[model samples]
Target chain A: MTTAIGQYQYDQVDRDFLAARIEEFSEQVARRLDGALTEDEFKPLRLMNGLYLQLHAYMLRVAVPYGTLNAAQVRAFADVARRYDRGYGHFTTRQNIQFNWIRLEDTPDILRLLADVDMHALQTSGNCIRNVTSDEFAGAAADELVDPRVHAEILRQWSTLHPEFTFLPRKFKIAISGSPNDRVAARFHDIGVIARPGDDGRVVFQIFVGGGLGRTPIVGQELYDSVPEERLLATLEAIIRVYNAHGRRDNIYKARIKILVQALGVAAYRNEVEAELAQMDIARYRLSPEMVASIEARFAAPDLQAPEGAAAVLAEQRAQNMVFDRWVRSNTHAHRSEGHIIAVVSLKPPGEIPGDVTADQLDRLAGLSERFAYGELRTTHLQNVVFGHVRQDQLYDLWRGLVDVGLGAPNVGLIGDIVACPGLDYCALANARSIPIAQKLGARFADMTLQEQIGALQINISGCINACGHHHAGHIGLLGVDKRGEEFFQMTLGGRADDQATVGKILGPALPEDDTVDAIARIVDRYLQERSGQESFLETLKRVGEAPFKEAAYDTV
Target chain B: MKRAVRVGAGEGLVITANRLLDGAIVWLSADHTWQTAIQRAEVLVSDAVSERLEGVQSRAQADGVVGIYEIAVRPEVGGPVPLTMRERIRAFGPTVHPQFAYEQQEGAGA
Candidate 1:
């Protein structure tokens, strides 16, 4: 018999807890079923897991699918606020949003409302499936072998309350990545899928299951061979079903699929998955060609005419304006089209918390999207906003407008583009304040001249290993740890954000809060001093290794 | 410093469960005062004074001086009334615990 993907499954005792919760919710629902409990009485239950209702009393839990939202999605969120909520929605660090002012009596009506717009809170708070997340740059980046979004979306549809998979022991989280360069923090997810091309020209996924970073941090085990595209959804269903049957249920923490994967050796897990796939009625649940076609059609890039003389225009801008040229080089990337460029709005400003877009800024971005870019937005896992289609001709205008709003910092891929979460200030789970640490580091690297010299570097910070800020994927990752009730910061070097993704190694002991920024500066200065010309930060780190930087970062301190 | 008070649009009303303790709907008035809008089916005085409301207790604690309550309010009838709060702290929105009132009590000690 094949073992489960993760060794831990809910036992009979765990089922008792799940049943108790269901009963509790059922009682609460019954009390308000016929409008008995007023709005005030029903709010606490919703807020516990970041859920809210919108206009017409429809419930909407902002999916924090890893705290990455694009300018368009951010704007669309504001639109959702205006249209559905009362022009205001609360942001949660789980990378989700919630509108608290909803009518509980109209929950089903709201679910229907979301379904009308191809959106639903389907397993948002339930024990069933949840939103499948991937690196926001899945398709657009120059380094990816294949877009992981197609796979993520495919999995998303398949797992939306699949009858057999819904009543699992506990919540499950899945993250996918094509960027081996480390865009998505794959190591800390229940099931982390990394897309790689095999020697046979087939797209293979290196499956890491049962890895998570909460109270217990463990790296996932690989449990699959090159799972082909056609069999991806079916394979995932089998894995979930296996976990549903075998995952631990006694303790909530142990119920995660990660524990199950850990308990079962990778070989055993793989064997189980293979056996389960073999026994399944694949045709019944397999994504049909027509369904795939319809979904792909919706995600298809919008048609646009290529602006003639785009190259010459960029060349002229570069020759005359160094600032504009630097921005274009760092912040803009070549689109599949001849004249269009995808622009990333780096949320990392020196001393600014990543992924926070103020209400006013949200409005301005909405206006900009309608004007320059086709009203499409994408949020990157690196905690930045992206405009998918921007014409080269409109680049200067967009940049100038963005500069007016204090968003035209050309540090998109540079050292200054830090990803940080709202730590102790807002998060009930955080042990230390992450925003201040990120702010301090951002201030240290605020100089545009210094940033240009360092080139593209991602510095991610997490208040805790829930990894909300994606600290595991950064080229230079900083994690906030609590020591004897005191806040301390740890630094990791050589992490990357591209297709050949590798988690950074820890550089000796953790630093005190006071010396954290300077320690980072020392590391950067060391790279500047020792690196050969044209060598990026990751390349320099790999070539010279973390020894030199570690010596510089800690020895003097 | 003068705090700015504006009539922002009435976002949806948030009704929580605690206000329904003993099956009564509790609410605060616009003037930062505790008052019962409804109690036990019958209209006990067409307009009851804020003081006569049931379970409206005030105290000076280590945190600050504030009122703790389990009062009820209904719109026109003795049912769940969705009253919109403006510039009122304690009754700003529907919350999980009616006990957790939003008061400027933090600055009261200061």
Candidate 2:
């Protein structure tokens, strides 16, 4: 038991596969550049390799495989950003990172470099199954019953260019969580799986299907309470097979699995899946106990030993500085290891862009991860990084190091911790810019005292109705709209992404940029004024209903 | 500027596309060449839009460019400027990162 990855580091077979894929893509790029292929023919191929033609330039998304990264992988990303992009890369809501300013001619070489580090741009985009997302604190969190990374990594292997599911009705996304707290927003995926402790002391799968967010946001319903542990993959295949055969293809908007599930009721959908499962060769698809154990054994077990007087050291450090106390209180999450804590690094600094890490910062953080953690870093759906196994005694020193790199913001889970999408600034589909508004809100809540006063709040922002920023799951959701030639923003209140997932409703009319920021301030102020002792913002909103909030928002408009 | 033939759109159009090799924003000049600066672009009169757009489409087929389209623009003292905010940002660059904007280039004054 040590920080070293066990026997299953991406072996030579995977390396050869990535090299072959990159070689094939390089030839395709050459053909396109030589004018042998038109944009129409080349678009899908490029998309399959995670390249997209955005508003200004070509944007390339690199897969993170459930947001896990080693020190070398982090350093590799930094190299790509410094050499290929504009000194920085954007972390997406789906736990991947994107380089915004990439040249078509330079993509093949960039991919070749990524392949050298055992990474490639495969299945990050296109209509095929996207990157499988899971709880960021999968193996380290205290509440976890099973390490979802074991299954998520298995799915990453299973879905990569699967012959049957390569071309579905539309794009598919799957999210899983090992805890009931549901950090990965499982209820809002095409297929949501929860790993829970079964009666016989084994982890059972709880399936939720037909949930998605876009033009229509639907909360996924439970398909099964307890699927046998070994039959998990087979059951997922059955659900996707049914969706592939029957989902609507005429309209792109209606092509998602949620629409199909809604059109045919959940019971009917379940029956169809059951019929498909009955017809398939279930034995071939079954995940054997040995197979599961083998996957688990490949992942390195944390060798975290309890350090004596760690709690006393943490208490003494907190007593030394009030800022350190606030940061420890907010950023420290419970860990399964007794002497360790999960340290959340907020990418959202005072008034800066959320989820953006510079080349220098990435290089420094890679070194820091090796020292504080077991050279492992996890990226959250909320656009933050996690050092999953920091010993309690070394936390203050780690915090000092992070501060030197300008990433030591103590705003984890506060209103300052906002999730925003790349809006009109970079995306072609966006109607307005999401970052500037997020910047305004971030600036408004920059003060640690004010943020702590406001308490644990999530404010999510999206450029359009595509909901890439997970605005539908925010406590205070802001959706950008285009009113004629102008950019307007609409607000929603009381949505959450926890176990009780709920989509927020519209609060009032859409406001212009500055007015929208003011309206949020007014709403937050009203909550602070009328809240009971230690009541959360959502709790206060629920107690008083939406009338007071609605009144406060439109009071000056 | 004359009223556009296309309904629910602005008058006076300027052709824009991304260069195929690098995906950089290019504006069509009066000589039918793609230029990186909007100041070098030739805004088309409403009467000449149909013919110029046809020629540009043919050029796009042969030239190394993708996603060719027309942007709504009105004549300014220095050059033809994009009307919509989206077009303006695309013609320039992302407003958040001003250092990379086309307006930062020499002679393309912001």
lDDT string, candidate 2, A190-257, tens digits: 99999988999878999999998888999999999999878888899999999998999899999999
* Lowest-sum lDDT 10-residue window in model 2 chain A: A1-10
lDDT of each: 0.61, 0.87
Q: List model 1 lDDT by residue over A443-505, tens digit each.
A: 888898889988878888887876666676678888888785467888888765344556667
Docking class of 2: medium
Candidate 2: which stretches are off by over 4 Å?
A: A1-8, B1-11, B104-110
Best-matching candidate per DockQ: 2
Interface RMSD, all candidates in order, equals 13.7, 1.1
Residue pairs in clash, model 2 = none
Q: Identify the candidate with maximal lDDT.
A: 2
iRMS, candidate 2, in Å: value is 1.1
DockQ scores for all predicted structures: 0.03, 0.68
Q: How far is candidate 1 from the true structure (C-alpha RMSD, Å)?
A: 12.6
DockQ of 2: 0.68
Best by TM-score: 2
